[model samples]
Target: MTAISTALPAMSRRDEIWHGLRDTFPMMVGALPFGVIFGTLATAQGLSPLQVMSMSLFVFSGSAQFIAVGLVTSSALWVIWAATFIINLRHLLYAANLVNHVRHLPQYWRFPLAAMLTDETFAVMELRYRQRGSEGYAHWYYLASCIGMWLNWNFWTLVGLVVGQSFPDLKSLGLEFAMVATFIGIVIPGLKTKPLWAAAITAGLVATLLHHLPYQSGLMLGALAGVGIGLVLDLRRKKLEASVYE
Candidate 1:
């Protein structure tokens, strides 16, 4: 309690934003290639420049929008819509986790911040909230981080669209490696404990085992399994700690 009390006040808005940007850079690397892919694919699928840009602005979700565009090209409207909704189901978890932190903000800020929240942004924010205990203007911190991600994503999307419109080989520019490297950087550090490792391996195996499931249901199931394993392990650990204290 004494340590938390002392540390909370020392963290200001500027410090929060600075650390948020630093923490967010690796994920931004992943977003760059993804944005380029979206831009090139949108052009290849015959969308106009305005429409291609609009997809980024309105949809704001990289994976969902990409899947949606593919479905659109194949005239699979209903399936695409369903898939988009499913891909975005993770946002519900984000919203639930962040509610206590951001609900105190005015509705205007809350709405836009929620709009900007992505998996990467949520992961960073969740760790921060867990560490810092949102006593001050934590919503501002979350927004600052979210804005960094949002602006970078839009900017790269614009660049991708322009390059896509001009060049044919833009997709082969070795952009895919950025995403792979970024994922490794983030996920490897996170595997510091046995529970985290167990959850990750379980999730991977479940995903591979059920890869044949249609409509991407396997992904949702795998995520559920991973979360359940983590929760059960965490609960058992807590019980052990409580017993030791007793």
Candidate 2:
């Protein structure tokens, strides 16, 4: 009976991981072209295949990689690093939000999970945490999602790097639009609350107005603006609720 009980839990956890992978498949479809496009553009910008793959492997940040590529030629090394750092500041917010759930995990488990974190994985994992409330096995689900995205990104990156060698004009095909459309798909469904809608609008307007900013600093500014607005509104709502309860 003891052995059976242990085996049952293991089986259940495996099921959770499988579910996470299944849920992430849709997002992977969107990320596929984005990764390929990055690979294509990076090579066009004079990055060797090894360098391109290394960036994807080690950094695992889509926006930062893109920004780095743009700044690589004309900008100083520090400038490229700083631009990518600023653009990825939003990950801090994602980590803060998820800290409570993963804090109990050991360093071994937590480190890789943290390393694999990305915008798309965060979105899906956040939704899962809300629904399931971070029972111990949730990390396994997160792991599955992270691994799915990591593999998807690396695989498509290789595809792009190989194909780009033959067709130098591959980027001109406008396939990057797939990434934009995918983001729309991801963002629209998450706007269930007033704060979310307000934040999205604020960020969109700020980014659009500041689109000409160098090194994509506009994106960082827009993200900060949206987060600030959302936080203020959320706090005000909480204060109002507290007053009503009192």
| Best by the lDDT measure | 2
Lowest summed lDDT over 10 consecutive residues: which window, candidate 1? 1-10
Please report, in order, the local distance difference test score of every candidate based on alpha carbons: 0.81, 0.87
lDDT by residue for model 2 (57-100), tens: 99999888998888788889999888888788889889998999
What are the TM-scores, per candidate, against the unseen true structure?
Answer: 0.89, 0.89
The runs of at least 3 residues in candidate 2 whose Cα sits more than 4 Å from the true structure, single-residue gaps closed, are 1-11, 242-246
lDDT of residue 127 for candidate 1: 81
lDDT of 1 at 162: 84
Clashing pairs in 1: none
Tens-digit lDDT track of model 1 for 1-246:
254453556567788778778878777877888888788878888888889888888788987878877777776678888888887887998899888887668889888988888988888888888787677666667877788888888888888888887885787878767766776666787887778888888887897899888667788888789889988998899999999999
Clashing residue pair totals per candidate (backbone < 3 A): 0, 0
